[model samples]
Every structure is written in C-alpha cells, then in structure tokens.
Target: MRGTIHVLNGPNLNLLGEREPAIYGHDTLADVEAMCRAEADAAGYALEFRQTNAEHEMVDWIQAARKDAAGIVINPAAFSYAAYPVLDALKLCDCPIVEVHISNIHRREAEWRSKSIMTQVVTGIVSGLGVHGYALAVRHIAEVRGRTK
Candidate 1:
C-alpha cells in the first residue's frame, strides 16, 4: 500500500507559538509540520501537512484523505466541539485516523473543551504532549500502515 499521511490542523492553530503559549506551548505550526514531516519520512511515508481556520476546507481535506491517504492525524482545534460535518466526513475515511491536541482538552476549564466529536471516528488520540503529539500521531499511523503492508 502507498504510505501517505495527511496531517490536518484546524482553526487558531495558525497562531500556535503566539496564541496562549502557556497552554499550547511556543511551537509554531511550521514547527509542528516539520516534526510530523521528519517522523513520516523516517517511516518512509509521504506527508500532506495542512492547516485551515475554515471548517469547510477541513472537511474537503478529510474527504480527499478517504481516497488518497493511508492515514490521517488531525487536530480539529475549536471544531472538535461541534463540527458534525468534519466528523461526518471523517466517517467516510477507511484509513486510520489519529486525533492530536497540543494541550489536554480534558483538563481545561470549560466542560465543553473536554468533549470531541472527532473522538468517535478516530483510531486514537494524542493529547497534552505539546508539539511532540503531532510527531507521535504520525508515528502511530506509520506503524499501523507498516503492519498492513
């Protein structure tokens, strides 16, 4: 099987290094992309790393991944709460999907923060590990892909 991993980010993740450094850490989205690239490359998998603030774009990417990607690692950001479209699109994907969060949403102040609509469709989740979570998510998909091969 072809090994192509799609790493998708949503919403304010573009402001990573500058947006709430205390909670999300100081790594920029570029930094996270680089980490995911390295991990994917090390495992001999091609990577498609992307981020968007728009929910429609995220849904489009997830839809594309259903046919073109071997696995996916997504950080749905604010959309994790109630973006049923994204979740519905994710349901179409047969490949493994891993959800990542730069911070532990479970420990956040708001109860809504702990709930992720994506949780039902993803293969697994990586949370609270800072930027390294992206790398770990990629690594997991790589491992799963390897096993299938």
Candidate 2:
C-alpha cells in the first residue's frame, strides 16, 4: 500500500440512502464506501472504512488513525455539533484530515446545523456534494499523501 486512509462516518450514516433521499441522495453507505475504495485504489492507497453511532468508538478509531493512517476522511454527522471529545481526538492526528458532509450544512435553515466543531482541526472540508463529498475527501488525502511521500 502506498499509504492508508481511514474513512470514518458518524451516526445515522448507516441509514444513508433510506434516511434522507432528498438531501443526502439515494446512495447507501455501502455505495459511498465502494466509491471511496475506488478513489483510494486509483491513487495507490489502502482504505479502512468504518461507521459507528458511539462517540467513544469513533474516538478510539481516530486515535488509531493517528498512528496507523497517512490521512483521514470523516463525516461526523450529529457529532459535528458539539462532540468535544471527538474534536480532541482528531486534534491528535498529525496527518491530513478532511471533513465531509453530504448536505450543505451552511444552507440549512437551522442555525445549529451550520456549526461544526470538527472544522477546527480538519485540514479541509467537503460539503453539499452529497455522497460525492466522501470521494472528494479520499481523493484529497491521496493527493496530499502522494506529495508527502
């Protein structure tokens, strides 16, 4: 593997296609993973894809990425609001981190939806592109990792 990239998804993501077809699109989580894998593979990188509803589990994954991954792509869903612990764990990572959001949180009418704690630590973010955002994030990691290598 040229490098390893961890693609982590937050709560409700497993329900992807069935959750909100209008905003999030009709693609399932599996579809997103497949797309990410193809993107990483094309860039000569290995992929580690995971999704969890538990905050602690997500933190543990982030901690693991700090040592085992060349980069990370995270879609923290609900955790984006105020998961301080998750934010702290992400801060520990020395590699590039890209935050992805299927919906354009900024355009949401709800004021709270626009706020993302993960933004503080991520190298960049891909939002409003639906499931394609995940692919973009992985592609970004691959490019950055390639340059670093």
lDDT of 2 by residue, 38-144 (tens): 99999999999999999999999999889769899999999999899999999999999999999999998899999999998999999999999999999988988
- The candidate scoring highest on lDDT is 2
Per-residue lDDT tens digits for candidate 1, residues 35-100, read: 998988889988999999999999999998897688999999999999999999999998999999
Clashes of 1: 0
Clashing pairs in 2: none
Weakest 10 consecutive residues of candidate 1 by summed lDDT: 1-10
Which residues of candidate 1, in runs, are more than 4 Å off?
A: none
Model 2: lowest-lDDT 10 consecutive positions: 140-149
Off by over 4 Å in 2: none
Model 1, residue pairs in steric clash: none
Q: What's the lDDT for all of these models?
A: 0.92, 0.94
- Residue 101 C-alpha lDDT in model 1: 93
